[model samples]
Target: MSTDAERLGWAEQAAEALTEAGYRRGGVRSAIVALLDEQSCALSAVEIGEALAERGRRASRASVYRVMEELERIGLLARVEVGQGIVRYEPLREGPGHHHHLVCERCGRLEPFTDDGVERAIQRLSERLPLEVSEHEIVIRGACRSCAD
Candidate 1:
């Protein structure tokens, strides 16, 4: 879990980036970014709106989706598909360092994981291939412990 200070720092950095990109920082946009920054897993637009409502913040579903799209445009968010045609959004970390997801197909659970071996393999593959791989995401789908039982 991220400390409140860390979450605030992320939100501040996002605000600065948005302002630098000639975008006005509004309540809905800020809230959406803050929520994404504090999250460890991706969330759908519907989930985002529900979370905001739980926190006493209100935004139309369309507005939330639009803000998410804008955030993605600014390189602050990435769209990840766990499975089952569900599109989710997560915060994009800086530079080439990022993690992958382990998704439970039976229960729609997403878990973030990092592995040095996988990273090295990806780097090697990128070197051997014609394309330069700056970033990558690998989603492994299976059943969770509970679901498998």
Candidate 2:
């Protein structure tokens, strides 16, 4: 979980980005961005709507999806497909410091991890290949410790 201050900072940054992109900072969008900022893992659109409702922030499913898509368009969110047709969204970090996911196939648990060696290897591969790699996502699927136990 992120500290309250950290989450607030993220929300502020997202609002600034939205404003700069010529979008108004409406109530629903603000709530959705705040929710995404506080989350440590990706969430589906339905999940996001439910969460907002739980907090007394009512928003229609369509509105939620639209706002999510806008956030993704502005690079504030990343859409992750962990398989089984389940699409999830998570906040994108500021720059190249973004992490990848380790998903537990059995329990559907998602964990974020970062490794300098993996980043270096990707850079080396990019250099060796003719294609210029702008970004990458690694999703390692296996049983988690609890599921294995």
Candidate 3:
């Protein structure tokens, strides 16, 4: 969603969003958010820390990890394991901030999109599971249409 404050990028929006969700934010949190946006990829905690350092914005490894864990616990971020020991965090929200991703493994491209079939599937699943699924994101990683050539 486009909030006047949300324009500051994922790191800034994350701090605001988390605070609205009842988490007290600090530099580490902001740094983590920026790192996520800069890398624009699903990254492990260590990778995140390293990236921050490379950008001349250093955050303690422990703190970086803690923020990642806390975000997940607070339901603001989702931990996805796309490969061996590789976990990354992604924000989830409906309305304007909602969508899924198509990750190109070969090209390292992340494409965001939403589809009706996904919505229908979630509705179907909620009926069978008896739990309210607010939103769902599917990361389909493979060759893109052009890459299929």
Candidate 4:
């Protein structure tokens, strides 16, 4: 999750990039970008469409897919594959908004968690290994509290 300011900042940055790339800054793409920017976790295209419908904004499935692809191509979105052929997309960012997912296998809930210990361990492992770690994603899976209960 990101702060309100950070979310807005991301939206602004994405909008600017789209404009600079000869893309217009409105319609379904604008709406999707704004909605995704405010999200705490990655969302599937179905989820995005449902959300937009709930907000009285209509976007077709094809349009949503198109915009998502465009944003990803421009480096504004990242794809997260949470197994079971399910894929989601989140804002691609760095710094304070960075975190990993806690996936609930039972309920399919995705939660974000940040741990300095895990980060430090990764750093140490990278140093010990021969490979340079350019990026990483850690997804912890289990039943969430409610599902467990």
Candidate 5:
């Protein structure tokens, strides 16, 4: 998990990058960035719009998707798909953003997980492989604790 400070730092960096990329600052974009900063898990464009509305910040779903697409293009956001045609977005930080997902196929609950052993194994595998691995994501699907009953 990322600390509030880290998330805020990333949000600032994202806003700067967008500015540098010539994306004019607007209410929707700024609101989206602020909303994303508070999230520990990925959210879909629809969810983002809903969240903004719930917070008294109005943002159109189309605008949310446009901003998300721009962020993804700039490498500030990562796309997460946990099956069932559901796609979500999360910030891509330098360190803590790197982790895998624990998906509950039964309830569609998604959670983040990290392990030093998994990281070491990936490093070893990368050392053995011929190609360069820029990134990787592992999604383990099973019933979450609640659904296990």
Candidate 6:
């Protein structure tokens, strides 16, 4: 339920953070904003670049990838890989219980899932597991409804 303006502000803030982190933000700013405006579920860098190109915006592939990395560093997006080499990028929520995702391997569809139980279990595991867990991602991958149908 975020307005486009709000998303732009978020992107700008993210860009500022990137600058602080020493990553320069350049022409790719529009590409990042366009991705937010489209609100595509989860996109790879190439996919983002193609989306901008469809709208007559010439977002260079390198710029799109750099923008994505900067956005990830600023906590504006989450990077997820579904047992594949391609990393998917999703906008981050400003509140707790960041929704999990279910990914369709064949169709590349992403569906959001949320449950307090998941958070509790993650916390419990962090306490016991040897891994240092700050943030975690959970993705269930399989054929989706339509694909199965």
Whole-model lDDT per candidate: 0.82, 0.84, 0.68, 0.87, 0.84, 0.72
Off by over 4 Å in 1: 1-13, 95-97
Best prediction by lDDT? 4
**Candidate 3 least-lDDT 10 residues:** 1-10
**Residue 108 lDDT in candidate 6:** 76
Report the lDDT tens digits of candidate 3 across residue range 70-120.
778766676665544466666645555556777766655556677878877
Predictions: Cα RMSD each: 2.8, 3.0, 4.4, 2.5, 2.0, 3.5
The estimated TM-scores of all candidates read 0.81, 0.77, 0.62, 0.81, 0.85, 0.71
Which structure among the candidates has the greatest TM-score? 5
> Which residue runs of candidate 2 sit more than 4 Å off their true CA positions?
1-9, 94-97, 105-107, 123-134, 143-149
lDDT of 5 at 109: 83
Model 4: residue 41 alpha-carbon error in angstroms:
1.5
* Candidate 1 local lDDT, residue 12: 85
- Pairs clashing within candidate 2: none
- Looking at candidate 6, what is the lDDT of residue 142? 90
Cα error, residue 148 of model 2, in Å, equals 6.7
Enumerate residue pairs that collide in model 3. Answer: 1-97
Ranking by TM-score: 5, 4, 1, 2, 6, 3
In Å, residue 133's CA in model 2 sits off its true spot by 5.3
Could you tell me the TM-score of candidate 5? Answer: 0.85
Q: State the lDDT of candidate 1 residue by residue for 1-149, as single tens digits.
A: 55666666667878998999888987899889878877877899999999999999999999998898888888777787867787799877643235788889887888888888998898889899887766677888899999999
Question: Candidate 3 at 53: error in angstroms?
Answer: 1.9
> How accurate locally is residue 20 in candidate 3, as Cα lDDT from 0 to 100?
84
Report the lDDT tens digits of candidate 2 across residue range 1-149: 45677667777889999999999987899899888887877899989999999999999999998999899998888787766777789887634336888888887777888888998898889999888866778899999999999
